[model samples]
Target: MRVRPFAVALMTAALTPATLMSCKPSSPPADGAQPPAADAGPSSTQTDTAFAALSKRFLDEGLALNPVSATQIGEHRHDSEIDDLSEAGRNKAIAWNKAMLAELGKLDIQALSRENQVDALIMRNNLEGSLWDSETMQSWAWDPQVYSGLAGGAIYNLMAREFAPMPERLKSATARMEKLPALLAQARENLDPARVPKTHAETVAKQNKGVLSLIDTFITPNAGQLTGEDRKRMDAAIETTRKAVEEHQQWLDGTLVPNAKGEFRIGAERYDQKLKFSLNSSLSRAEIKQRAEAELKRVREEMYKVAQTVLKDKPGAPELPDAPTPDQQQKAIEAALELAYADKPGREEVVDFAKHTLDVATKFTHEKDLVTVPDDPVKIILMPEFQRGVSVAYCDSPGPLDKGLDTYYAISPIPEDWTDTQVYSFLREYNKRLIHVLTIHEAMPGHYLEGVHSSKFPSTLRAVLRSGVFAEGWAVYTERMMADAGYMDNDPLFRLMQLKFYARAVANAILDQGLHVDNWTKEQAMDLMVKQTFQQEREAEGKWVRAQLSSGQLATYFVGAQEHFDTRKAWEAKLGDKFDLKQYHDKVLSYGAPPVRFVRQLMLQEPIQ
Candidate 1:
């Protein structure tokens, strides 16, 4: 959803499964669970003050424990340091989490303001989730991508942004670079080759070397910006770090990959737990699958109707009967989509086309008076090499702490080694209409706009713990919202692409559970992506890899969108004719990026726990 620093991605990749058990703190309710009435407990301003202080302390200490995360969140105080990945370092973090959980337990939730109650609950979930990840999941012993993200992000964070002057940032970069080898050494020490999933190992094997490329891209060019001793030290650090990265690459290939025999699938129990934490929703695995399956059918039926419009009377068109059989429905949808695919950009023109789409989507959002469009600068750039091989594009907004910096709408370039066939497949998948849908999801009224609104809230704590479900959900929701509102002049092709994209999100929910919990084979996954969702071969293939590399993430779009849709419907029901679209949107985003459930509760004056 958001991938500014690959570090967050890596951290989440490793520590994805989280279970919120009873903590020392007065057991904060799990996400979406009802809390005590606001006026039930002793009313006191003192509890609010205490909890606020505790919240700040937790963030400060927690950031100190993971310097890379601190940097990504725009806390530059730890810019020169890398995370301590050693066993002792991890134990120290666990202890810190326990201590904080204990402190949080002493607070009175009902006594605090409603806003503070939400923050308190989020803090508790965060603390308990960290413990569950470290103590229960023990991902550190298995996941190599976790360490890779940290190892690369140490320098990437400093160089990616201009939060500080060039010389200052370079000095920080040098300090982190100097410390990187030991961090990599710690990763090597911590990872168990037998426990490392082969896919993860292979992915990191390719990515580990990308750290050097990062230095070349971000650090080497700026080395001349320094002088004398500082420049000399940076040069020395760069050389040492390069050797370290090379050695790490050797280890990853020669040792890790060959010995990586661990299962990529986290299995049913772990998948369920991770779904709970990652989604922070009431929806269970079964509920998600059921809803996703139903949506898949309903959306396809709608697409078939659109197909009839696009394919009506065309030569070689599939039969579009009013009540078509399954085979006919599939044929009709595919034939109509071929028309959309015919209008795709060339391999070299994807980024340029995306830029144009952003402008057009922005103008539409403003003209239609959709949610207020922020003036925050957004740049369309190539996806960084270390972060490639996953999803096609990600919105990398500035860290909430970093005020008015640029939001990078990063699209991965078509790989050079790929044949013309592969490139064409990729282009057809990301055709002109789909690109407009993507622009709506990632930049104009999606992540970039939501991020701007989220940062406007004064609470740093909320910004630091923004929910992926809410963010990703809003993006997917917008694609349909824009299409239904007649974006692109009520173009049926655009609507079809939008529905197809939504279907992919629905399929993502099913695919994730299928692969992780249901023992789905590659063939089964391909069938779902290519045949059912109407994805291009290249897109399906990449998603298969993405599904294995990360669990619970692919489903966030569908789960989040469902919640957003429900929340909007609830408000519409309550307000009746008084409900205004722009106002509802502005207010929904105003609460920072909390889970949609919490946002709903807050908006509806329900008890937030």
Candidate 2:
């Protein structure tokens, strides 16, 4: 579950375009996935042999670098062990990326098949800018011990969530959990106090604070269910593990935070370099920022139009504050939210609705031509306690490497102590704006569809080349697609809500790159989200925090979506009447969720390696 095809700093969009693409493409008259040719580097015969060898070496090196990923993916070639978290482990990866890049450059990408060539380009990109992130950009410097995916995958391996059966899975987990403390100890040692990011340090300190909250809430109450002496041993292990996590948290707070001295924001040069290698997009950073800014202006006007459709009947609902002016927007946004969910039922009703919505939403995928639906039903599970503060709702799919388990549309419960007004206010913001959008993005034809397709993408390189820019991009694309396809059927209010979600995506791109790279203020972030995205104040507040905690990620939804749509349209227009939604989606997703650059080449039957 923690396996990353690429060691992207956050998500794929965070990647810098030049860093992502090595074979330069001149602008085609009509755009396609294939980039312009590199200066005829080498003859095809000479390059293909070396390129094929490069692919195997890279995949082998990647797995060796991330053993936990191998175990999580059901490869189980190394299930008995965990990763060494020492400085050596980190350095080995850096050296591997450098070596891989050097080997990749020895071959000519234009000589390979379109798909293999794309893979090669991705390899070059992942190695170039990605190396800077791992070596120097030092995001881990801000927050090093964010290993919940490791912990979460430990549960995933034990549970029958993946292809693993109950006994084998559980046995592996038990062994790994037994060794977890040593791994955590290594994490503590290798993770430097002096290099930690301040905000990252703070957030991680808090998340770790919730580590023991896991035992208090789940394990302590359920320990007795374990079998015989196994139960006793497991109980003892959990307690020790819980204490270990707590001790680490104390070290983080008492030792690390006080001395964590790294710059919170990556300086412009580092950010630029990271962006170039990571994104692999055709556009440069300034170009992406410019496109995002233009999108911001366009989405703002579109947001007002959508809000008018939803709130035409409600007086004072048209009031939207300016992106440059945050306070006024915050107050107005709060008021619109108050009006939206004014009739919301109790908290139980909200949770119950989310459950039902998943049921209803999943049914549509199979019944409609929207996409090829999954046979394994998507599961709408409850959110784990340890992951609550980040967001109230998220869709967690089976790891692309794993198969068979239901993808969870996890929703957090509202706090029991809130007054009716506060509950209503929160529910109102979500019910109309967030929930349905999340449903489409996470479940039907969004992450769920992307998750399955990613599992099938032929190359490990393509999988690593996976872009949040593409994944969230595809999901957000669906928000608009579903509406255009008449989702919720004739309910303009829902469609209006859909646009609001898009507005959020567009604004998110602006907020993330702008805030971290440009040092935009809280007011600046909030105002843009609320005024331009039509996001409620509470929603904007949460998104702002999410952008900070996760830099370079917010751009994925909007940028990814646009690339998917644009690429599909180019192919369709080129395919000229041969286009079918089912066919297009099949071809588009069949290559897995790589950067649009790679996906275009794959769909057009070109090489990536």
lDDT of every model, 2 decimals: 0.80, 0.60
TM-score of 1: 0.92
Q: What is the TM-score of each candidate against the true structure?
A: 0.92, 0.80
Best model per lDDT: 1
**On residues 1-609, what C-alpha lDDT tens digit does candidate 2 reach at each position?**
111333532212222322111011112111122232344344654565567666666655565565565544334655655655456766776777777877777776667656557666676766666567666765433455445445444444444344554445444555666767876676576567777766666766776645445445544555555577666666667767777777777887788778777655665676566556555555566766787788766654554444444555676564553342444444444444445456453577655766666776677665677777766665667777555534457766543334344556677777666678767667776774457666777767777666665556445445444565666677778788877777787565566567666777777767767776898888887768776566667777777766666655556566677777778887887789777887788777776566776677666655453
lDDT of 1 by residue, 1-609 (tens): 553321121233245322110001111122212233456454556676677677668767777787887887776888888888687888888888888889989887767777778777877777777777787777788888888888777877788878889999999999998998998898899889998889999999988987888888898877789999999999999899989998998998899999999999999998887777677886899999999999999999999999999899899898989999999999999999999999978777776778889889988899999898775457778987656644567787666656556768898766767788877777788889988898899877888788777655555566667777888888899998888777986689999999999999999999999999999999999999999999877778889998998889888889999999999999999999999999999999887777789899999999885
Model 1: which residue pairs collide?
25-105
lDDT of candidate 1? 0.80
Kindly report which residue stretches of model 1 are placed more than 4 angstroms away from their true locations once superposed.
4-43, 375-394, 410-419
TM-score of 2: 0.80
Residue 62 of model 1, lDDT score: 76
